[model samples]
Target: MDSNKAKNLEQILESSIKDPKDLTRYLYYRKKLKEEGLSDFISILPLGAAINWARANSVWPLTFGIACCAIEMMAVGASKFDLDRFGSGVFRATPRQTDLMIVAGTVTYKLAPRIKKLYEQMPSPKYVIAMGACASSGGPYTQLGYQVIKGVDKIIPVDVYIPGCPPRPEALIDAVLLLQDKISKTIPQQEAI
Candidate 1:
């Protein structure tokens, strides 16, 4: 069979069978072997389960706030919104101590380097959340502003953008939840080869 057919057959055997039409020549044989009790399916189950768990609850965030929107970010960190519900309440000031950088205000030209440096300081598996329109895309200052850097994403890789002039605390919570969803979709990091 061609490489494409082989790849499809492998996918059929590994994932849901979908239908008889979904199975290619190789998977048809594998199904017959399973009916005859030839091979075990439990062998790779542990790794698959570990991957699912890793994708669910492993998020850390850095509280990197500047300008006015920084206040809203603080409110999210406070009692009402309780960012801990998303497992990201521990607002680490240093980038080295966090995985997600919550860009919570206007990123000025001078501050852009600091933002980039902090992003670089983070370990592997780092993520960023641009909180507010200012942090996301310059907001009211977008019309030819000299000092404003527009968006935090220009300097650092932003994984989620929470849009608003200055997003409410509830909006910030939603952004955190969105970040959680993104976290859930990421491939789990594997052990070193």
Candidate 2:
């Protein structure tokens, strides 16, 4: 369907829903469909939907782990956890070649500059996932250490923050999936590297 038709249909649906939760759910799905470049009539047909699906499933995260959390990040890629199932097991060594950056450890003041540099190297519409307590908030060293950054976000814009001293492999997988969901909803501004 055309954009105008889709908008009319959305208005009808929004007006018909009285319950707040149901309306919210409806709006969320509608937004998801729109992000994928689909309308109610075109959703069944695969055009724009296929492109978004491919983008969502084929996220290549840069291999840039720093501290103890790096070990957990590795575990997620191991056969036992199998991050490949999420289509994000391939960790590119080059920042220029990847879309997702998983900062899986502590970021000290000294390392913040390098992190920011790497983030800037990533192509447009890139994403960062802060994947540990230390990376997210400096963990136990938040107050005591002057060298450690309170959070990686101080250096780069973090899209998802996973809270754990060193989060379990399962948590990393969940974070990747969540990042995938976010990617699916976004309209890429540039071609994938």
Candidate 3:
């Protein structure tokens, strides 16, 4: 199929498959097509933009809370705020399964290396969100605590920085939304060619 036809088909499928189960079936079929040695078929499909859109919408965050801000992060996942609406509610236990790492508290000098290790373990196109002043720039500990790392960005790249001693849950939601926007804007390398 031509790229335009593929794009149209993708749009139709997206519009038709609102249920999660239907989406899963669609993904299965796509995987099957790829496994059948259909490189040309896959290349012509608008899989680049479609895959990025899927990644942006369904960002599975790593469950790695650090401090007080971690509580606020949890609140976002709770009933009142309902982060599931944004498609980022599912928190994965392992770095391998998670695409987003929300560093929701302080990063000390000792923990910096471990954090970097976790970041390295994550797959490509992973994102880091510095979700508090402490994670962003060591909050109250910058001057007082000699052992605290100044910023998480120093250890691994941070995509979004939400500032507060312990930012509100709403701020965490906003940060996730911002990260989604950023991810959606990314052009897959294949599309660049």
Candidate 4:
């Protein structure tokens, strides 16, 4: 239905619910529907919902991995784990062609500048996922003097941090899912006339 009608219906339902538990449940589901991009309030959107939905589904990650986590990232792309099912299996070799960066390994101070440069090359609305303890916080290499960068986030803004010595492939998949949810919530800038 239309936005106004939907809002009115929602108000009526919320007002009519005498039980606090039922009202809470209704609000929770309503928020969940909006996050899932299934809400009927699309009329109020600046046509951004459709674009956000597409971005959420078709995330192309940059094919740059630094450590052992790269192996797990590769496994996620393989047929068994099947990351392609989520439309994020095609990892691009260049930052210009990708919207997602999965820092899947340790980040050394020497490599931090390159990571920052790559992140800068990415298009607007790009996302970064730190996919291992190393990438997230230097992992076991944190004490290696001025070698390990401590965290990839020190160079680029990370959207999700999956912690593990080298997080499992399943963890990478979950991080992608989490990133999709974050992308879906973004309100795009309305186009000027």
Candidate-wise lDDT, in order = 0.72, 0.80, 0.84, 0.82
Compare the candidates by TM-score and give the number of the best one. 4
**lDDT tens digits by residue: candidate 3, 71-133:** 888889999999999998899999999899999888998898899999999987799999889
Residue lDDT tens for model 2, 60-127 = 99998898999888888889999998889799999999889999888887787888899999987688
- Candidate 4 has what TM-score? 0.75
lDDT (Cα) of model 4: 0.82
Q: Ranking by lDDT, best first?
A: 3, 4, 2, 1
RMSD of each: 8.3, 9.2, 10.3, 9.1
Please identify which of the two predictions, 2 or 3, would achieve the higher lDDT against the true structure: 3
Per-residue C-alpha lDDT of model 1 across residues 26-53, encoded as one tens digit per residue: 4566567778786575222223334544
Ten consecutive residues with minimal summed lDDT in candidate 2? 41-50
- Judging by lDDT, tell me the better candidate of 2 and 4: 4
lDDT of 2 at 14: 62
TM-score of 1: 0.71
Question: So what's the TM-score on candidate 3?
Answer: 0.74
Question: Which candidate tops lDDT?
Answer: 3
- Candidate 2 backbone collisions, by pair: none
Backbone clashes (count) for model 2: 0
